[model samples]
Target: MINLGEKKLILASQSPRRKELLKGLGFDFEVRSKDTSEDFPINLDPSEVAGFLSAKKAAAFAHEIVPNEIVLTSDTVVILEGKILGKPANEEEAFEMLFALSGKTHLVTTGITFLTLEKELTLSDTAKVFFKELSGQEIEYYISNFKPFDKAGGYGIQEWIGFVGVEKIEGSYFTVMGLPIHLVYDVLKNL
Candidate 1:
């Protein structure tokens, strides 16, 4: 367990998984998310996409942060063959994304940014997720039932697809889900 003394932690995200992960850490915090553009420079490297968006999200709160409050923002990206795979737009896109991910390994990167009135810290972690060869039926069933439009790579590792399709993960499980709890805990505990 960790204590923040007089400081209040604010999560600037709407992700249920992120909210749940932070709450599971036993920290009392408030969720205040404002919609921000996800677009970034097309020239940025795939690996830097999350970090850039995370920092952009944090900067969205620059005018609202108080001295005793810490705002945490995070973004996760799925990269395959050097291309970034974002959340799907619809069932067709979801199916396509999942189909493309089948029988391949992809990198899941989550970038976290902690902002206070005085200082800021931005960091990212990468996890390798190997998916077992998937069938069309598997892809259709998962997409139709789970409707993973909110998750990167059109999948959630904590969901049914993860149990049936994911072969193995090389990094923190929490990272693939959304936030890297270990890194988040370490940073928050030290703060």
Candidate 2:
């Protein structure tokens, strides 16, 4: 187990998956977040968006960080064919996004940022997820029951859709779920 040694940990995100993953670390951390815009430059490569956004989220707490506090922020992005698949706005959009991902492999990239009063460290983890060919009924059922409008790529890998659709994953499973907990644990050990 990693010890904080009097340093308080803060997670600056409201993602339920991230909160759950952090909790699994057995650390007592506070969940706090700012309403930072997730917008990114259109010219950026799909692979860089998560890191950029995670850092951007971390920047929201820059002036408030104290010497004994370590603030962590993260963002996850789903990429298919070199483009980012963002959270859908509605059911139709969600269905369309999931349809596009059917039977294909995609990348899930999670960027994490650790900031103290002295220094900031930002890193990212990427995972390749292979999906089984999904039928229309499967997509509709998942969408209707899961209501994945708030999730990137219109799905969460830990959900029912993942159990039925994900054939294999080439990287950390937690990355697809939204937070790379193993990587987080590794970094936390050194903090």
Candidate 3:
């Protein structure tokens, strides 16, 4: 467990995966996020999307932050062939994303930001996830059951597809899941 002396932690995100990952760190925290647009500038490099969004999310708390409280915000994306793949809008889009990812390696990038009344820090982590060739039936089953419309890459790394199709991962698994827990721990420990 990591300790933050007299500091209260606030998570400014709605992602269940992020909440769960943060809980694994054994710290008490409160969730507080405002509705914010996820859109980004057209010129941002694919690699910078996550970090840019994360920091943008953190800005929502700019006026309300109090001393002794830290706000955490994060964003994640799936990049293949230099294109960013965000949450799919529907089953058809999800199927298309999954099919494109089939038998290929993609980068999963997550950006995390820590904001306090006095200071702020933002960082990004990337993981290479390689998938096995996914059959149409398998893709349909996973999408129909999981309905990953809210997940970047239209799939969850902890779900059924990952169980069978994820052949290799090159970085922190937690990053692919949405929050890089190790980095979070390290940041909080030193803060």
Winning candidate number (lDDT): 3
Query: What would the per-residue lDDT of candidate 2 be over residues 1-191, giving only the tens digit for each residue?
Result: 78899999999988988998899899999999999999999999999999999999999999999889999999999999999999999989998999999999999999999999989998999999999999989999999998998889999998999999999999999988888898889888987
Give the Cα lDDT of each candidate. 0.94, 0.93, 0.95
Q: Which tens-of-lDDT digit does each residue in 80-113 have in candidate 3?
A: 9999999999999999999999999999999999
lDDT of 2: 0.93
Collision pairs in model 1:
none
TM-score of 1: 0.98
RMSD value for candidate 2: 0.8
> Which parts of model 3 are misplaced by more than 4 Å?
none
Model 1: residues with Cα > 4 Å off, grouped in runs: none
TM for candidate 3 is: 0.98
What RMSD does each model have against the real structure? 0.7, 0.8, 0.7
